[model samples]
Target: MSRRALRGVLGIALLLILWEGVARGFALPSYTLPSVSEILLSVWRQRQLLASAAWFTMAEALAGYAIGCVAGIGIAVLLSLLPPVRRGMMPAMMAINSVPVAAWSPLLLLWLGVGIASKIAAVALAVGFTVFLSALAGLDRVDRRTIGLMRSFGAGPLSILWRLRLPTALPLIASGMRVSTVRSLIVAIVTEMLGAYGGLGWIIYQAVVQIDFVSVWSAILVASALSLAFFGLIGAIERRVVFWR
Candidate 1:
């Protein structure tokens, strides 16, 4: 492994060792703080159930992520093309975005019901603003001189956006997308915890009620893994798409 990877592994190992030592030394109860080994054992024993819940949660996260990305990019492009509309709409969008996703979750659950729709909507809302701001900033980053040159050469707004603005904005857009992957999963899970038929969050809630801390840790471990995978996937795609960077 590379030096960075080796250091990361070592850091994690040290943390796990410390965690295990504390749990054992204090003789902590399973309901309070289960050892790392106990959590790992529970994870293995309950892998099937955890896997099912993970799939359900991932489905909600992925659907919302897709919708958010498309909507964010499309809106940014449209607003860039229409300065008047952008001026009028930006404040409203900012006001709405200012509200936390958790605050919106209850309203969404009430409107969309406790089903997958609420979770998806919550995730979408959280991701949409993040991407929208990044994309808008990126689109606006084009040099005024470059835009003037393009216009002088008979390049219309659409053509300039396609050939100049979009390319210039790609790095920022990709960064937003990469960041959104984790947010998407987090929003989905948090919304699921409020009310969901099935998900990692739901499992965690159940475990907590039953005083099953090991199960809670296991579910968290799974969620962490899922988030890492999602983030890594986005990062990989960003590296490929933003090859010039």
Candidate 2:
């Protein structure tokens, strides 16, 4: 591995060692704090639960991310093509983005019920503004000369969008997806914690309420792992797309 990668791994190892030593060496009670070993053991014992919950959470996060991406790209294209739409709606979009996900989760649950829909909606909302802005910026990055040349060639709006803007904007879109994937996962799990009965977040809530610190720590670690894996997948795809750039 590269030196930077090796250093990162070593840094993480050092942090984990510190955590283990502090918690275990202090002989902290299970309810107050559990050692890394204890958390790992608890996670092993609850493998089935983690697997099932992970599937649900992954589905919610990915589904919501897809929806948000579609909506953001569509809106970006429209806004780029029409000045009025861009002027009238961008501010409102920004305003919506400013609202905290915590405040939105309960309302979504109330409107959509305590089901997958609510979780998905929350995740989508968390990612939508970010993706939208990325896409808008991408569109703005299109070369004016290229656009004029396309226009001079008698290219229609759709043709220009498909042949020029989309390709040019791909890097930005991919960057947004990388960010949104992680944010969507966080929102999905948090919304699930608030309303849904199944997911890593729900498991964490249950652990906390039951005073199962080992389980709580295990759930947190699993959630972090899942988020990292999801982001890595996006990063991989991004590298493939932007390789020539």
Candidate 3:
């Protein structure tokens, strides 16, 4: 492994050691703070349950992310073509995004019900505005000189957008995608807490209600692992797509 990778592994190990020491030294209640070893053992005991929950939550996150990014791209394209719409829509989008994703959970649950749909919608909302801003900025930030030159050369609006603007915007769009991936997981889980058929968040809720702190910690660790894995996937894609940047 690389030096950076080794450093990261060491850092994580140190943090885990500190966590174990603190939990033991403080004699913390299992409900309040379970040790890493205990959490691992719980995970082992509940592997099947945790695995299913993780898969379900992952599906919701991924679905929502796809919906959000596609919708964001469409909105960005529309706004690029229509200045009036951009002016009118930006504030509303900003307002919605400013409100916490958790705040939307109840409303989404009310509308979408206590199922995977609600979780997916929440994730979409959480991920959308970020991607919208990035895509819009990417579409808007093209060089005026280049655009004018393209027009002088007889390039039409569609041609300019497809051939020049989109290429310029890809890096920013990819960056937003990478950023929103974590949000997607978070929003899905938060929404699941309010109501869900089954998910990591739902698992966490059940564990908490039963005061099964080990299960709670184990579920949380599973969620973290999922997010980290998804984040790494996006990072890899971004590196490929935005290599020039």
lDDT of each: 0.95, 0.88, 0.90
Query: In lDDT terms, how accurate is model 3?
Result: 0.90
Per-model clash counts, in order, read 0, 0, 0
Per-residue accuracy of model 2 over 1-245 as CA lDDT, tens digit each: 87966997899889889989998899998888778888889999999999899999999999899888888888888999998888998788788888898899999999999899999888877777778889889989989999999999999889999999989898998899899988998898888888787999899889889978788888888888898899888888898988866
Model 3 / residue 191 / CA error / Å: 0.6
lDDT (10s digit) by residue, model 3, range 50-142? 999999999999999999999998889888988898899888888887889898899989998998888888888878888999999999889
Q: Which ranking of candidates, highest TM-score first?
A: 1, 3, 2
Off by over 4 Å in 2: 1-7
How high is the lDDT of residue 130 in model 3?
A: 85
Q: How big is the positional error of residue 197 in model 3, measured in Å on the Cα after superposition? A: 1.5
Q: What 10-residue stretch in candidate 2 is worst by lDDT?
A: 122-131
**Top lDDT model:** 1
**Candidate that beats the other on lDDT, 1 or 3, i.e. the better one:** 1
Measured against the true structure, the TM-scores of the candidates, in listed sequence, are 0.96, 0.92, 0.95
Best model per TM-score: 1
Candidate 1 per-residue lDDT, tens place, 132-217, comes to 99999999999999999999999999999999999999999999999999999999989988999999999999998998888999
